[model samples]
Structure formats: C-alpha cells, structure tokens
Target: MQWIHNYQLFLFDFDGLLVNTEEIHYLAYKTMCANRGINFNWDFETYCRIAHYKSEGLSQKIYAEFPELYAVEPSWEVLYGEKKKAIIELVSNGAVQLMPGVSSLLSALQKANIPRSVVTHSPVELVSAIRSQHSILNTIPYWITREQYSHPKPNSECYLKAIQLLAKPEDKVIGFEDTPRGLTALLGTKAKAVLVCQIEYPEIPAFIERGVIYIKSLDDLANTQL
Candidate 1:
C-alpha cells in the first residue's frame, strides 16, 4: 500500500494479471496442437518462454524450437484465427472469468484518482472482445496494445512508449506484470515493477533476485493505505 502511494501512474499486463484469459489462451493452444496432432504439452517453463511475445512472435519462437512445426503447423494467421475463435466460443459461453481481486484493486485505484493503463501484447480485437463481455475497461482510461507498438514486451519498446504517452517521470510510475518478460520490459523503464505471481513459474527466483516484488494477488494490496 505504501508503494501504491509512491507512484503517479500505474501500468498493468492483461492476460494473467488482470483476467483469467491466460488459461483460455493456453486452452486455445492446447486445442490447436491436438487438432494438428502435434505432441505439445507445455509446462510453466515452456509457456514462459513464449508467453510474453505477441502472436506472430510467439509463433516464431515456437517454430524456432520446433522447426518441424514450420512444415506441419498452419501459418500464424490461420493458427491465430483458430485460437481467437476458440477464445470467443469459450468467453461467449460464460466459460471465462476475471481474475480474483481485479475489480476491487481497480476500484481502489480509481477512488484514489491514480492514472492507470494496460500495456499488453494482446491485439486490439482480443482486448475488445474481453472488454465487450466485462466492465474492466471502464476503470482504465488508456491502453497500449500490440497494434500501437512497433515492438512488444521483453523488447522494452512498448513500455518506453507507454511512459512517453503518460508524460510522467519513470520513477513516478509502477507496473504490475505476470511474466518474466513482462517484468523485464517494465524494469527497462523507470517504473517500479511488481510480479503478480498467480501462476507458478520456474524463473520466479530469478525475478525476485532482480529485486522485483511478488504478490499473490491484487487483494494483497487491499490493506495498503492509498
């Protein structure tokens, strides 16, 4: 809570940090692999490697490791189309839900008049779909999606752009991220970074070693004085 008062701007990652959509994405990938008969079973380690990239970059990262997939797998366009369709079906059927503590934390920030925004690798269409189904977007005045940036997370370009857009000093901002790469991107900027450890990943120690604060959920901040 003391940290919340230290920042003038707050930035957040979308998938696992704000919503439970990461599981939806994982399911989409799992379904795609099954349909293609690809022997794909992702543990946290493997997921972390490609999780921070945008759709195209993720495909490229996966293909580099499994070149055989390049031949057997559908083009990124086709594969992503299928993934999006799957997400749409799941969300439309009331299968997906927001992560716990998201509403309360956002409301707390709003009540304090802190400027907050989402910086995510998700494309605008996907973001729009989730927003249409939920009221999450109402708490955020601005967002930087993949479509707005030339480079995505782990590259630092998107975070840098966000700071520029906010016109705030980097030291006066804070970022909440759920992945290693997302943390790296935020650290590249002037903002203090926190790791929302909703999912256990093997690289968590490394992040902690780098001085990133980790929290179980946004609810942990409820007792913090704004």
Candidate 2:
C-alpha cells in the first residue's frame, strides 16, 4: 500500500488487473468454441494457463489449440473476432465484475490527483461496455485502448506512449499488470512494475525468479486513504 504512493504517475493494464473479466473471458472463449462445434472443454484452470500464454514473439496466435477451428475458419483472426463478440454479449448480460478493491483504489488515486491512465490492448467498445455497468471505472481519466496503438503487450510501445503522454520528467511512474506479457512491457518503461493476480500460472514463477512484485489483489489499496 505504501509503495503505491512512491509513484506520482500510475498506469494499469485492463481486463485482468482492474476487473475480474478473466472468468468472463474464459466463458466467452469457451462459448466461441462451442458455437463452432469445437469441444473446447478445458476447465477454468486449464483455460487460464493457455490463455496467459504470451502472444508476444508470435503472430496469428490461436488462443484455442483445437484442430476443429482450422476446419471451420481459415483465419485465427476470425476466431478471436468471434471470441470478442461472445465477450461483448456476455458483458452485455452483466457478466463482467470489477476486481476487489478496484473501486477504492481508483477513488483514492482520483482523490490524490495523481495522473493515471489505463493502457490496454482491449478495444474501446469493450471498455465502454464495462464502464456502462461499473460507473466507478469512469474515475480513470484516460484509456489508451487498441485503436490508439499498433504494437501490443510484451512490447513497450503501448506503455511508452502512455508514459510520454501522462508522466512528467520528475514524476516517478509505476504500472500494474496481471500477467508476464503485460508486465514485461511495463518493465521496459523503467518504471516500477507490479504484478497483481492470484492465479498460479506456470509462466509466473519464471517472473517471480526475476523479482517481479506479485500481489493477490488490489485490496491493499483500499487501505490507502491516499
């Protein structure tokens, strides 16, 4: 909690860090496979492991490792598109929920007037969808979404651009991410990077080896009056 105050500018990764959309995303991905008659019955635990795989060094990454998809669709983009569609539908049904302490953390940040922005690869439509249901999210003044950047996570381009726009030369910057892909990118900024997730992804231990700070949730921020 005290560490958060060390930074004057704060950046956050969306989807996992600020919200509990991982479960919704897992459901949406599973639904996409089911709709196409692909029996993608990986339980939540299995889906989480695969979903957290970094798409950084790879192109056209297929989230589902099923052969059934190649037969039904030529492009993996279409699968992701369908997955996005399902996610929006589920979100429309009030499926998305804010992660614990997100509201209090954002409120405290706003109260302190520390400059903050959400740097995410998520589309603006999905961000807006969540905001519609959780108005507390509106406390974030800037959202650097997919449309604003070309390169994604595991590349610092997105975060670099956000820092350039939001940080002053004298301000210490800190960023929060839920996975190694996003955390890798945040580390590139030379800002203090924090990993926040309770899920035990196999990929995470390698990061822990490198001394990445990990937290189960942002609930500690709720204790910060800012």
Give per-residue CA lDDT, model 1, range 96-179, as digits (tens): 677878887787778887888899988887788788877856679888999998876788899888888885554488889988
lDDT of each: 0.78, 0.80
lDDT of 2 by residue, 10-35 (tens): 89999888887878888887798889
Best by TM-score: 2
Q: Estimate each model's TM-score.
A: 0.82, 0.88
Runs of candidate 1 with Cα error greater than 4 angstroms are 1-3, 37-74, 222-226
In lDDT terms, how accurate is model 1? Answer: 0.78
For all the candidates, what are their Cα RMSDs to the real structure?
A: 3.3, 2.9
lDDT of 2: 0.80
